[model samples]
Target: MEQYAQDTPKWKAELFDWLKSFLIIGSATAVIYLFIMAPYVVQGRSMETTLHDGERVIVNKAIYYLDDPQPGDIVIIHPDASGENWIKRVVAVAGDTVEAKNDQLYVNGQPLQEDYLNENRLKSEAAGVVLTADFGPVTVEEGSVFVMGDNRNNSMDSRVIGPVQLDHVVGRAEFVYWPFNAIRMPK
Candidate 1:
């Protein structure tokens, strides 16, 4: 009976150790998901070619705390108070002038090299359609960013919503991690 008692205590101790480990791991994961990083599922064709609908991406929520978002950074933004998040590429930052003429995007008087839109641009031209419509020479206000989608013709971006306030930005998209075959770092 003494041997049985000792064996029971040993089994219980081992189980307790495993439970502690699991709790620690679960807590760490929760912390990362809540404050450091988060998984976001792309919802529409707005960011297509660069990010397709239903692609899973990891957003670095803590990154903006260290540095301001820059042009060309793909970011998740809450455009309105409705709590809906949209992913887009930052085309212009505070004080930069943005314009789209003849289907070309110009920021601060210089044409942006949007190599990511090569496929979409070619498709548009082949179809005799303008990829990006003509818009403002308006300067981005302070603490705001001008965003657009890689699928310029189909995206509802800053062009439709105006510049997004810095505070509305949720995070920068680091990479696509889903659909196994489509895994890659978004440009």
Candidate 2:
């Protein structure tokens, strides 16, 4: 039956079209994930208040390619050769001097306003504890940044690992997308 043969080919053609569309979409998604954007899971309390453990964030991997990491930008970093990643706030960029004294952060000889740490600072003050201990007068070297956690007292950051090389920075964290009720763009 000539008619039956034509119908069979039409159905096969439709299936082929569907398969091709799916292939194209899959490729686009893979490209974006590899070079443009990717999801990262926050793993510790280091970024607490701003980002909590187990929270999911969408990192804009392509951003740093267009702009250098700057103070106050939340970024994802590959600190060392062990393949571990960290998320932290950039406190000082190349050539900037950073220091913490009397629980206040100073950069370039001026006190830095850290509104993001308001809650934690208040809590520490209430508890008669120092949030960030005195350290640094350390200048960030060329092509590196000084990073710190929002939960200053409990974080392992650039203070512990030294200035993070710009090449080690993975991306800027654009926003948190998981646990619907907790969704927000970290400042």
Candidate 3:
């Protein structure tokens, strides 16, 4: 009985040390995940050829607080309060006029280039179909911008839901971090 008591303090000390280390490490992880960045999984082909389903990436949640979303930025947008988010590319910012007609993208009457797309394939597939449909010459409302997926024909984005408020955007993703071989900076 005396031997057990003598060892109690040593055991308690070791347990306390472990718990303290755990708490500190946990707190740091929580802070980084909640405020700095978050891991997000791509859910669908909406962002295909850019972000694949099941692909994992770290979203820099602090980015928008520092820099406004810009055209060509790949961002995660929350369409509602359900916690579901969509990843898409910013096509136009507040006050910009945007349109998709006969397979061409136009912003403020100037052609918007999408180097990520295979021009020939898109032209052939979207021939006379107007994949994204047409609109605008209408200016994006203040505090909102237009977004879309690289897989133009398959994505439902600003063209369907209308320009999204900047506040609805969660963050911008710059790279893929999953599946090893597919890991790299996203275009």
Candidate 4:
């Protein structure tokens, strides 16, 4: 009768340990990726220069729930209050009157001074309804927001979608994570 001893090769033992560690690390990473660090890719130029289309970003879903959305902060919102996501710049907060005329934007009846826009995009576009000679001094309802794109003429923002309900907001973009060179804090 022959008996086989339990002595194992050092290389085999080391390999087994490495594989176990990798699996643990990989699984933890995936869990965090789906919940905490979900990835998003920009689809339009609505947030151009700040968040370009096709660029990838990381949304901190845990944060907006912790705090309210702030004006001028870029946010990811569900346009229809339905579960789909959309990204747009926050223009006016609740209770503010927003108007656009002669390529200028006025919030609360005061000129909205922005250092972000190099060229205004609201040229010749009617305030509420585009291509109409009429405009608006529309008041954004409480718990709602008026969002617009830096590329005004091209973006279909709050002007087109109407005021966004607060509950529709998904999260604020924390940073851009792709395209290596453009990887940095989103404006």
lDDT of each: 0.94, 0.94, 0.85, 0.75
For 74-170, candidate 1 gives per-residue lDDT tens digits of: 9999999999999999999999999999999999889999999999989999999999999998899999999999998889999999999999999
User: What is the C-alpha local distance difference test score of candidate 4?
Assistant: 0.75
| Regions more than 4 Å wrong, model 2 | 1-8
In candidate 4, what are the lDDT values of residues 1-187, reduced to their tens digit? 1232237667877898999999999999887775566688988776775678899899877676576677788788888735677888888888888887765678888877766765332432334434211247888888887777776656778887788988887777889989998889877
The sequence of per-residue lDDT tens digits that candidate 3 reaches over residues 4-73 is 7677888797898999999999999999898789999998887777789999999999989898999999
Task: Write down the worst ten-residue block by lDDT for model 2.
Answer: 2-11
Deviation from native of the Cα of residue 181 in model 4, angstroms:
1.0
Cα error of candidate 2 at position 140, Å: 0.7
Question: How badly does each model clash, as a count of residue pairs?
Answer: 0, 0, 0, 0
Runs off by more than 4 Å, candidate 3: 1-8, 119-131
The TM-score between candidate 4 and the true structure equals 0.73
Give the residue spans of candidate 1 off by over 4 A: 1-22
Best-to-worst ranking by lDDT: 2, 1, 3, 4
lDDT minimum window of 10 residues, candidate 1: 2-11
